[model samples]
Target: MKRKIGWVLAAALLVLLAAGGCAPKTPTAKKKPTPVKTEQKAETVPTYRVVADNNLDKFKQTHGQYRTINYDPQDDLVSLLPESLAKLKKYPQTTTVRAYVTDWQQASVQMGSKPMTVLTVQVQKVLTGKKQLAKQEIRLILPGGFQPYGQYDKGSIYHDNTIPDDEPVLTQNNQIPIPTIGSTIVLPMRKAAQYPAKEYLAWLKAAKLTTAYVPADAHSMIWRCNPQTKKLTTNNPLREKELTKWAGQGNQTWATQYKRLTAELEKQL
Candidate 1:
């Protein structure tokens, strides 16, 4: 009986050993931790502010009392002849027209000691002109950057600044509090003209108008027609190239119209 019991115990020990040998082995090397990735936030940029003119008091004293002149398309002269036309014969007089300020920009050239504003205006009615120029848009460069003063939207009444004279002032669209037309103020404008009607239609067939801006200057070669004379005037080559590049980035419609007007003029050349 004792021998049988000993054999039984020995069998149990063998079973336990076999179970231990079949078990999986533990790992010897330690596992590495995963690296953490960090994300960064982007920085924001601020808009530029126009430096306020400190000469306001002096300007008021010199120019006299501040009087707001409301815009009146019917009686006010809104467009002026280009400085180039100042000496030209048969040059047309500055005209009064009803127009809207579609957009505005800072004049690339500075005035006296301050920056000027260039307003993009669309003509709605021609109050006074030899030829009625309606449904046209042109650029007008004013004396100062008036954009900071008020909102310039489609409905804003853009009138002459009478107190200082010649400068432009803006009243909110649909809000014309004053109802007076003071001494007329004319905007420095680039007038658009076409080849004579008889010549323009025929010229469009064979030639195309290409419009571009004159560099460092607001004038567009596309808007101005070639003088009636066949002689081509010499231009500053370097300046021309620069303006062309600048116009390439501006309003394409304005450029296209300029090109069309220019192409018509070029036919005469």
Candidate 2:
């Protein structure tokens, strides 16, 4: 009786295995992939301050403003005009243009690490020389604008100055004010190729420009003008001296030179 019972139980187990009742079941739900997170960086703000070259060191031990760092000598107009005209023949603008500052950038000249101001000007009128640049936008580079601030002692700020030197501020030499945007002005311009390896000729090659312009001289090249009134003035003291020199030759006063210059430029136009 016991042997028959065991054989019957074994048969039942075999039948259940053949029917696939013990097989593993497939998963009911699929897993979802995790999403990735990306990080964003913030833009850095630049700090800048304008200071005269003489009064550059104004912390702890104060630097006097009396000394001259880059003083321009009085120019003789009689000699300057002929030489300027001859040089203009080699460069662009044997002519002058009345333009407004559309935009500007401060950069360092690679050769000497000197500061320069690159201006984007829109010509409003042709004052003298030629009319080709009239109503055209152009670029001009000039010396002495802004330079990277040098390292100075920060802990020695006991005297009077409050700012720290190592704070990464751009120290601009404001002896000649940077031409303000939208301000009308007159420029006597020339190609930068004349100053190969010295000025902005090689530095601006990355811009892919055919060429760029520069002033004949740093002092008298820019003249601030009222767009509506057409009154002209310059920030450079040497420019006044040159006009005074011209006035002296004509038996007139320094103030009269402004009108005379305007008349001369208009006659050329």
Q: Estimated TM-score per prediction?
A: 0.24, 0.52
lDDT of 2 by residue, 1-269 (tens): 99999999999999998889867889788777787777676765312112211122332133222221242323344322322333433444455777767666654343354555677777777765667778777777655443323332224344224443333343333335566555677766666766666334556674433366766644545677875665667746555676777777884554454455554554433
Q: Write model 1 residue lDDT over 1-269, tens digit each, in one string.
A: 99999999999999999999999999789878888887686664211101112233333454454333333224332222223322221334444343444444555544333344444455544434423556655554433343322332233465223233333343221111211111111221223223246443343322221110111122222122122442222122333454477588874554344345333333433
Q: After superposition, how far is residue 184 of candidate 2 from its true place, in Å?
A: 0.5
Clash pairs, model 1 backbone? 155-173, 211-259, 215-243
What do the candidate models score in CA lDDT, each in turn?
0.36, 0.55
- Measured by TM-score, the strongest candidate is 2
Worst 10 residues of 2 by lDDT: 46-55
Error of 1 at 150 (Å): 21
The alpha-carbon deviation from the true structure for residue 49 of candidate 2, after best TM-score superposition, in angstroms, is 26
Question: Positional deviation of 3 in candidate 2, in angstroms?
Answer: 99
RMSD for each model, in Å, please? 20.4, 17.1
